[model samples]
Target: MTTSQNPTAQAPYKQLRRPTTDRMIAGVASGLGRYFDADPTLVRVIFAVVTVLTGGLAALTYPVIWFLMPEEPPTAPPWPTAATTAAPAAATTTPAPTMPVHGDRGPI
Candidate 1:
């Protein structure tokens, strides 16, 4: 039976994205773990074994995936956004303090 016809059918998994935290290198293992519903430690152990057994070919391939794989966007922190962020008007009102040109001697 087709999935659409079945009322119990679940939606397909989302595209893989590297997580922002709980990662040793690029979060590839953790991302894979989340996708497959597996333990990340197991994945990391497997990767390490494969890399060693294959004379580090997997090591080189890891960076390739890191470069290609999209990282997950950072989640908003639970903080007072208004107090942390400066308003555009307030920024314009206060000019940044000028530094003395040519060291601390104020203008040589």
Candidate 2:
């Protein structure tokens, strides 16, 4: 059935997912570019300009967006890839102990 014929039919909304590819900092611009149908470079340039014009407000907001926007889910590795299969030794190994932090130092 044609989309025009169905009143319930609607265009798919673009999700703001942080892509793993074409990322400089946190894939924010790349994901935004894909969602808004703009070039990643253009998005970056616009962000840079906004940051400068807004007295670093954009810079501060970027991190907020990075934290809010979820990273794109990892895709399954291709077949026959080394990462796809675990070695026998690796499977039998135990996790290493984490180093303890001292109060004298800054936040751990």
Candidate 3:
């Protein structure tokens, strides 16, 4: 049996920029989180440690990123209410025919 592929499967990843909110410092962690799909808290923790280790040079670096990085716009919901409220179309009820195998096709 052949499987149907989704038409929207090839959509590209959205470009990530700095988040506009939830920032304690300069939103640098949030920007990195968006780019890498990682937790912002973890990024912040690492940045904090690095800042300490580097004698607060990293503290100076965050503001530069804040100034340079663009802010991300808020994302919208995937579907509209009309689409969600409509009843789903009925699915085909016919059973698929089984394929006959020839000889030994080792552990297919």
Best by TM-score: 2
Candidate lDDT scores, in order, read 0.73, 0.76, 0.70
Q: Write the per-residue lDDT of candidate 2 for residues 81-102, one digit (tens) a residue.
A: 2445667886799999977676
Any runs in candidate 3 off by more than 4 Å, and if so which? 1-14, 74-108
- Candidate 3 per-residue lDDT, tens place, 12-37, comes to 66654676665666667877875776
Any runs in candidate 1 off by more than 4 Å, and if so which?
1-12, 76-108
What pairs collide in candidate 3?
Answer: none
Candidate that would win on lDDT: 2
Quote the lDDT for 108 in model 2: 71
RMSD for each of the candidates = 16.1, 19.5, 13.1
Tens-digit per-residue lDDT, 59-90, candidate 1: 98888888888887665222223446666785
Stretches of model 2 off by over 4 angstroms after superposition: 1-12, 76-108
Between prediction 1 and prediction 2, which has the larger TM-score?
Answer: 2
